[model samples]
Target chain A: MESIRKLSFQTSQFLSFVSKNQILLMSLLFVSMIFFSLLAITFGSYGLSIVDFLLGKTSDIQNTVLTEIRLPRVILSGLAGASLGISGAALQGLFRNPLADPGLIGVSAGAALGATLMIVLGGDIFSQYSLGVFFIPLAAIAGSSLVILMLYFMTKGFGYEGVTYMLLVGIAINAIAGVGIGILTYISSDSELRSLTFWTMGSFGGVTWPLLIPVILIIALAIIIMIPYSRQLDLLQLGEPEAFRLGVDVQKLKYTIILTCAASVGASVALSGMIGFVGLIVPHLTRLLGGVNHNYVLPGSALMGAALMIIADLIARIIIQPAELPIGLITSAIGSPFFLWLIFKIKKL
Target chain B: MTISAKSISLELGGKKILDNISMDVRPGEILSIIGPNGAGKTSLLNVLSGNIKSHNGNVSYNNTPLESISIQERAYIRSVMSQFQSIAFDYSVEDILQMGWLDHSHKDIKEDLSAFQNRVIKECDMENLIHQKFNTLSGGEQRRVHFARTLLQLWQPANTKDQNYLLLDEPFSNLDLVHKVKMMESIKAKASSGTGILMILHDLNLAYSFSNKILLLKNGRVIEQGETKKMLSARLLARAYETFISIDENPINIRYY
Candidate 1:
């Protein structure tokens, strides 16, 4: 009896410790994200001092570069990273499978296919208008939603027996999408081909405030919709029968979360092209720090994701001066080794 | 409070798992469904608990149709402790207990949960195991801790009109003799305190000894059911299991010889 009291007391103390420390960590990370964003915006091929920019007394060249190129790229990277991380964490919880990610389920591949198709087919027609940029994202979102819808039905196709079939079908669709991407790359002209390759590799080179709206809005909406269902997700982790016993409408919750993930992944991919590991890695990190509670995992992942992208962007700038490396490469290089170490550490726990 | 499933039948994958099984339990009573392997004891428990749907007939609690109630509403009244639960992550025993209390419909019980938890942990002899990760515990220890969670579920005071339903599927399968007796006693005390429980038991002695009512199942059918002592007989046991068995009443020991 005394031991149980002690245990309960200890658990509360631990939770309190995390709660207090989390706020401090979030504040620190937030300040750092802002600092990195300013650094990324102001430092580039041409230097613009923060004081000069704030004073609105920038040189024409520096102003054009800051307003046109750097700011958009920095802000977009942060938004894209947040979206990928939040969506990945949410999907992991939704499926109760840690390996589950938007990339693995073919959502990103579908979005990429949609973008590739837009690039190849809309060249002359799209080049005529400013609507061209929005067109790719629209196509990507549409394509991702379509694929997710198809997978949803395929999973529900067998009426509860279809669940096991969902992941298998997801793998098949992902493989098919990979082939489609390969074929598209095979037929493109040099410049378009190189641009496509760079885009596929991922870049924040042309990111602007105009691109930020949809990405942030969709991610924000998905996160908002998902938070209220956090407790339901907790019940879900107990396994389906127990979840059902606890009054969660399993089918409805599953569909809603998957659609949310698809929408967020589609938006981020359409904007950023493709950034790997953020979605898969952030959730594991959140789980490590906060346990498996979705309430903490979802929001916590968003902050961590935002910070990670900014830091990655900062590293990309310093690595090669006057020449830039893709921020995506930095994340993968950093994320892969960290993820491997995480796997080993988790095994021990 | 009363929970009853009438003529419940379940079929899955073109195979009929349960056929025309009907059972009932009232508040302050225990019902033990006893049967051999594949006899649909677990299926019946599932049907009553709303974890699995019945193809035919209906389940009603306090005379209200079970299907009309939302899952959340049903959850407030019923909690099931299955045969096994496995998860890749780790959760402390106290954390699992909190999960149990968190599911209760009453909003006011949140503060009282810690006190009730202390009571349950003492009852289940889980004092030392409270901080241990659920997955790290032995099969028997996990069962006991889960049983403690189950007790918390059963002891919740449901809304006045709602009936509390407890479902245990082979809950004793992993326990040693001592823990089995301890679990049964805890369950009996909860029943007396107002939880209506339906459990599947393989041991006839435990079933006959603790249950106020016994359900004899054979081939997914309720072959016989009544007062525990009156209907528990060697003939019923042999017929239900389709095996030869002997019941010696002199010292009340049952053997297969």
Candidate 2:
């Protein structure tokens, strides 16, 4: 009885300590994300292992496969996941609704439409301007900015009833953007059509080191700028007037969050297509495990998002063995069920 | 030395919401603004709290224009709790209360729940509800939680030099009678400690009993503004509210027929 009592007391103490130190928990989660990323880099069709690479026993072909092909792919997936997760968490906080996500709000659809347009129609425009290869991401950013701007105006017009109207406007804009993409698909040549399909489904198979660099830079910049707004976002959970009276510059904060989310989601979609669910579910999971404080939810979502995406990409790569599945298929397959479960849980509460 | 609004006016969608209203909220006093529905009491509070910009004239805090002060700097001097406190997230009651300390530099949530915050929480009878999700609470409980949150914002420990302000809109609307008296007593105690409070109230008796100054608004205009004893006569209140209100003096009771 004495031994059992001692063990129980120690367990309670440990649980309390862990609950008190959220930064430590977040750090551990980030380390796990890094581990999973490295593990993901080792799991392509080629039989390369980290053990062999570390022991200096890797063949030249194996080394090239690991470093040149799989490394950038893994890094891109991680960045895309992190960006989506953080943006989703931020947007959810801004709207004060858990259902808000980058994909659901039409930002992803807008970016996909922009990239598709660039793929199908920008050849002549690029050649005329001598814009070598930067047109796709630039167009994606422009498209996202336009959609976010429209959302801002629509919400502003609705005044105090903005949240519900914002969601409706997002749905309408998403439907319209989908129609535009359909039109682009109809006019594209065979090769452009194939790439557009692949882009819409979202695959990291096409990522290379050169293309990953600028995409990583843009996403990194956006996420870095977004972390500081977590406190203001927390305040905003109390509604705009309350937040403003508590000394938040609500207009400025809203504009900054919208622009940052646009940049991050636009760049991620440009690089990896419209991978869904990472933004939606990862933040929910973070809040469930770590609480609703954005200081924890934001960084926790980034880490968990990176880990989940890396694992999803790994599954996408190996599930078909030489024939890769789209990363979006795996994420949605997992995400949709989790979302339903969340609804039921909230209802139960 | 006080928040002064000079000839403030607001028009929304070509409709006048507030028309040339001027008032003063002084230190160490409870000033109540009482009016009927659509009398623009809430809108006037918005203008004074800097949530809404007035179309004409200016609002100044301690002799400086309110627009010139940064939001972060203004947070140290004033905290407002509006009538509507609809929080969408399932944050714990403790989490909602801790958000009051957002402007403070304390990063530790446990340590930031200072002695004053605890006393306010205890005073509001929120000790039993602190661990529960805020959304799960009933309407009256939620109001008390938010009341405690607003109080926590201006609560300073062992320091009474700063002249802070609390702007509350219909704080006693959803509270029960017992809690309402408790809340009024707490507000009086805070005012006695040098914190200025401006509140909008529908209960005429409570306003008359607690407020040092009273402003009566009608059709977006001030009907009367003076000491509560002078401005709260039966004739003026009846005329402002368009109802027959009788005031009883010794114990301070009001009845509307």
Chain B TM-score in each of the candidates: 0.91, 0.92
Q: What is the DockQ score of candidate 2, to 2 decimals? A: 0.29
Q: What is the TM-score of chain A alone in each candidate?
A: 0.81, 0.87
Tens-place lDDT digits, model 1, residues B1-257:
47978888899898888888777888888888898888888888888877788999899887778887667667667788986556545666776666665433344555566788898888787889998888789889988887787666555434343457678887887787777777877888878778788888888877887789998887888889999888768888888888987866549554321
For DockQ, the strongest prediction is 1
Per-residue lDDT tens digits of candidate 2, residues A58-143? 99988888888889889988888998999999988887777778887788889888878887876566445543446777778778
Q: For residues A1-349, could you state the per-residue lDDT of candidate 1 as single tens digits?
A: 0111111211232222134555665576678778878877766666778788789888888777877787777877787777788788877776666655666567777887787777677777545676555676777777787777787677652233444565577678778876777787778773443455554557766666665666777767877777666656766767778777766788878877777777777777777777767888887787777666665677777777877787687677767986778766877786768767856776676
Clashing pairs in 1: A247-B71, A247-B72
Q: Which ten residues in a row have the lowest lDDT in candidate 1 chain A?
A: A1-10
TM-score of each: 0.87, 0.90
Poorest stretch of ten by lDDT in candidate 2 chain B: B102-111
- Indicate the residue-level lDDT of A109 in model 1: 76
Best by lDDT: 2
